[model samples]
Target: MAAAPDSPLYLGLDFSTQQLKAAAIDGNLRVVHQDSVQFDCELPEFRTQGGVHIQEDKLTVTSPVLMWVKALDLLLDKMKRAGFDFSRVRALSGSGQQHGAVFWRRGASQTLNQLHPDQSLHQLLQGSFSVADSPVWMDSSSTQQCHDLQAAVGGALKLAEITGSRAYERFTGNQIAKLCQSRTEVYRDTERISLISSFAASLFLGGYAAIDFSDGSGMNLLDIRTRSWSKVCLEATAPHLDCLLGSPLPSSSVQGPVSSYFVRRHGFSESCAVLSFTGDNPASLAGMRLQQGDIAVSLGTSDTVFLWIQQPRPALEGHIFCNPVDRQAYMALLCFKNGSLTRERIRNECAGGSWETFSAALRDTPLGNNGNVGFYFDTVEITPSAVGVYRFDSEDSEVSSLSPQVEVRALVEGQFLSRRLHAERLGYSIIPGTRVLATGGASSNKEILQVLSDVFNAPVYTIDLSNSTCLGSAYRALHGLAAESGASFFDVVKNAPEPQLVATPHPAAQQVYDHMLERYARLEDSVLRKSCT
Candidate 1:
């Protein structure tokens, strides 16, 4: 039977670094409504810049827990005022910025279960967190903890083999260790430790939501193979850590129905299922419908490249997470800190601050930029730990300068080439029918995408939607409904709009980039070696 026009809806929410966003989709998988609350602009009382507070040491970064609660209250109120029928929402799932930790107070679960419909969530739950300022993903103050953790598990390689990642300073386990060591009282008072993804789902679940396998892989504590917490890692980090973290759940697991507080206050149906939420990147993998042979390239403030893998080769440089969609599969991620901002800086310096002028330069220069490759790192780069600009000529000799047009082409080409290099280092390769799914601000520019296509030697594709993560969460919600009945993630989203083919590799692209890649690798190594010396 065909569904009615006013059929059940699924809601996906994203608790990002700077904002909280939501997208609702109907049974047909078309977006019905979208909304967001920007923390910096909407909540000035918090006085947060970029929705976070960087401590005096500049290494500790945090977001006020109550601020997120207040933003949710405000977002729901706005939706209610807009006459969004919450009763029609059959299920909900979401994504949160990865690696951020939230510490629940001893009696926080009680406070959550007893939420009053007449009161705002922020008002009732202001004291629910043992740590008022939760350490976010931007924090890098847990270096000591990261080292300690890596040592506890033998070494970085051993840890990565177990947890799907090395002990990154921003990872939740290290952050927890830092708290336990630095703030002993706070750690003692913390009843439960939830990653940001599970923490948001907890609000709707009326208790605690188990961290999904996909997001739990970000912490250096999960045994990704078993999809459970590692006892060695837990004992090394803190006392009774497993009790505080609870058990890990599958990403599509139906947590339960929505809380009574939401049903009474916002008219949500009592039967509305809440699915386990995952990390923003994993959610995006679902949204983009990335297949086994596809690579997803996000060119936002920080460029990120991710892909689905049947067998993961965990490394220290990039991250490997349990695939959110396929229980038996995994995903790999490579981050480059210098993305749009670096492009913008180059555009301003060489093209008078005009993307139009910048693109014109790209069209003006030939492919491979006459074998003039440049590594431009405005700030420190994450993938290859390097800084400053280093230009190399066709002969692989370091050069000091190039023409403005050449500089422009070199910058764009270098960025994509580096992505390909590192992605391959993580065991990613271009097979027949491989597609590059591109998103983020820079993806809209065809000229830039042309370079991306040429470097990877694959057809480039782009999605029309601006928020893939939120949409992915919505898709996850619907998948949760069908998962128990044995529907695959692809089966659930078969009707999703196909990504538009933005660019295709030039016939000669393989020949040109094949040689350029070798030279680029040598130059990058030289730069890194020089930086050390």
Candidate 2:
């Protein structure tokens, strides 16, 4: 007999950089209810800007641990007010901003187990973290730690071969090393270290949660092929690192039922299972159900372009993370740190802080901005490893001046052109007829996406929801449960809804960016070589 139509629902949460969002999906995989709490606006008590605090020195970027805990409390409360029935939520899994590590105090496990329904998580867990604030992914202060780690593990290539990417300063391993070196006593008192995703799941699990393989791939410690911690890499970072971090779990596997704390507090059943949480990008892949032919561009706080692949290859410019849906497959990614912030800055300078004017300027200026290409990096960029604004003429030569309208178009075109260039090197094919699927906050902007389509010379697409990470987490929960019930993941997603084509490449404009890509690549090479990255 077929299962009941009113089957238990699955809950997915995304602890993203700027906000905490939750989504509920029913047995049919349709989003039932969803809500979000923006950290900067909703939780001003944390005094965080853009969901982070950048130290005055400007290298350190962190968010208060208590603020995240409090966000959970507020999010859940808001969800309840929005008519989310916790009792119907049969399974929960989530995605979080990758690389950020949370240091649990020695007694944190005890605190988790003893959570009281009458109290908030932030209230009960005030002293649960060894570190009050966690070094987030935006932090690039671990430059020394990255070098030390690469040296300890032979070299950059060897380490990248083991992990997915090179020793990125924002990676958890380097961040942990920095913490240990900066505050030895706090590192000594830490009982467990959790990635941002697992840390959030541990709250519902009522104990330390294991890191999933996909998220683990972002850390410079996990051997991606084996899906386990690399001994040499671990030894290089910290002492007995394995003791602090539990074995990495496969993303498809279920962690366990929700703890009695949640059972008592929110009416969750003892039978409600919690799946292992992974990084937001990986989770977004699962949510988008990315296919081999499609390229996914996430335009959030950080702009990233990723595609699905079967084989893993070593590349310095981008990343190859284990697929969240399939343990065997891999996903290639190129992350640009100056995503929304850069766009916002350009808008402020050129359009007087109005996205409408920015869009109008983009449309007003002809595609390619008359052969002028601009690379805007308001912060340290991950792709080219460069910083600051750069403008170049038609011949890939540096130019001094441009109009605000021209600058706006150039910035948009330059961003997508760089992605196209690096992605090809990372083994992503960007042919004339390719399709680009867009998601995240900025993906909804048709004007911005039009530039993407024009530059890539491909049609752009968007799913029903812009925030696919949480929805994908929800889908993943149901998919895992369905897998246990004898249904395949591919079948579940394939039978689900298809993304709508949002924008098609302009025929004449496509030719312009197609030709400009070469110019952009030349300038990109010169800039990267000069930076000595």
Candidate 3:
């Protein structure tokens, strides 16, 4: 049976580093309208002197809170242009870039409200922060802090055993420690430090500070089993956690109603409820209709491989990230910093011409590139390691020494092989029966998709949705609303649109991939051993 046409529209806002993207979805899980607005981050002044990185002393960079507010306003305008009825929007939630901190002052409401021509609450909160841009997840300057916290909690493996994750430079707890060490004055003035998702939700609902489990898990401060802030982790890192942190909430809970001020300013009706916000990746998993044995691969500037697991698994060799989206689902994630960009570089510099030309080139080249050649694509490694290294190698040194074309193919094949190995290590059986959903820029490349399919010997699927991240956020918003009215979360997802295409692996190519994968594993081990020593 079809869902009723009168079902309420759910609004999802994806808060990324570069832009804010908004989407509206109906009860049938169809996207009705979508739009995005770009925002700029103030660059910090830095210099390279005497082979060491130096930053201007007392330097503080911050994002204009007006940017988010303006983004919201522009989204509303775009929605109106798309013929969407703002009043029909039933529930709203957000998915933000995980681990970015936003500080809000407790007693400055009167001061905040009077400061603006624009009624954006995000802008009003700007005055409350000493630093504009908090150390985002991409910032890896907190390596020392990560090492310190890991030692304090125990060893890296022991830390992962307890918290279900290992210490990383980007995790919130480490960033907080870094700030305290470097800028103690600013850390002292901090009031309520919240994740970007919770901050946005708080802004919309007037004033509240609570994060969903998915977002909290990314902080490295939450105990995976307890689903709450870990006192041991916090005390070991930042002892004075008083107002700097907030309570953790489930993703489906309604944090609060849209504030009257926000309603008056944005012309939104008072009937809308704000659902708890979550991490964008978790939201994407929900949006993809992910299940056990199902993997979702996102190939943007970076590649993230996500699988839903029933048990609380420890972070794999400090390479995997496990975070709970809800009570029933935990996401095991592997992210690669070098994904589509590496492929694009290969296409432009190596293959020459458009992506179609690149695809054709791969097809023209025989399986395994006709010999023992492979490509290593790495701008950085998000999972497994913070640094990235790329190299092309061949069993036949003559083949490795000769042709750049062979080297390019090798690199591409190596990337696919690396993903396969990583998946296998995580206990995912990458055999013929596994369901692999590929979404991102690389998914559009027939050659890459076919190569991936051939390598995995599994069916590769892609959907028509161009921006699956935005779609995922919209799906979460819808689910959040439905959960409020006694709807089963899994049932709502089971009714989502079927995948667009299913590309099966070629039997002939699988044997070649099997051999290449063995070589790739050996190469990866050597690289890791060399890097560590």
Q: What lDDT is reached at residue 291 by model 2?
A: 68
lDDT of 2 by residue, 94-146 (tens): 99999999999998899998888888898999999999989999999999999
TM-score of 1: 0.94
- Segments in model 1 whose C-alpha atoms lie over 4 Å from true places: 1-5, 348-361, 364-366
Tens-place lDDT per residue, model 3, 434-499, is 777888777877778887778877778986545656777667667776776877667676767888
- TM-scores, all models, native as reference: 0.94, 0.83, 0.82
lDDT tens per residue, model 1, 1-533: 45565689999999999999999999889888899999999999998999999999999999998898899999999999988999999999999999999999999999999999999999999889999999999999999998898899899999999998888989999999999999999999999999999999999999999999999999999998999999999998999999999999999899999999999999999999999999998998998889887899989999989888777878878998999999998889999999999999999999999999999999999889989999988888888988889998888888999888999999999999999998887768789999999988999999999999999999999875478899999999999999999999999999999999999999999999988888888889999987767
Q: What is the lDDT of residue 16 in candidate 3?
A: 74
What is residue 350's positional error in candidate 2, in angstroms? Answer: 11
Pairs with steric clashes in candidate 3: 61-132, 62-132, 62-133, 374-410, 374-411, 375-410, 375-411, 376-411
lDDT values of the candidates?
Answer: 0.93, 0.86, 0.68
Query: For model 3, where is the 10-residue window of minimal lDDT?
Result: 43-52
Output the number of the lDDT-best candidate. 1
Model 3 vs. true fold: TM:
0.82
The 10 consecutive residues of candidate 1 with the worst lDDT sum are: 1-10
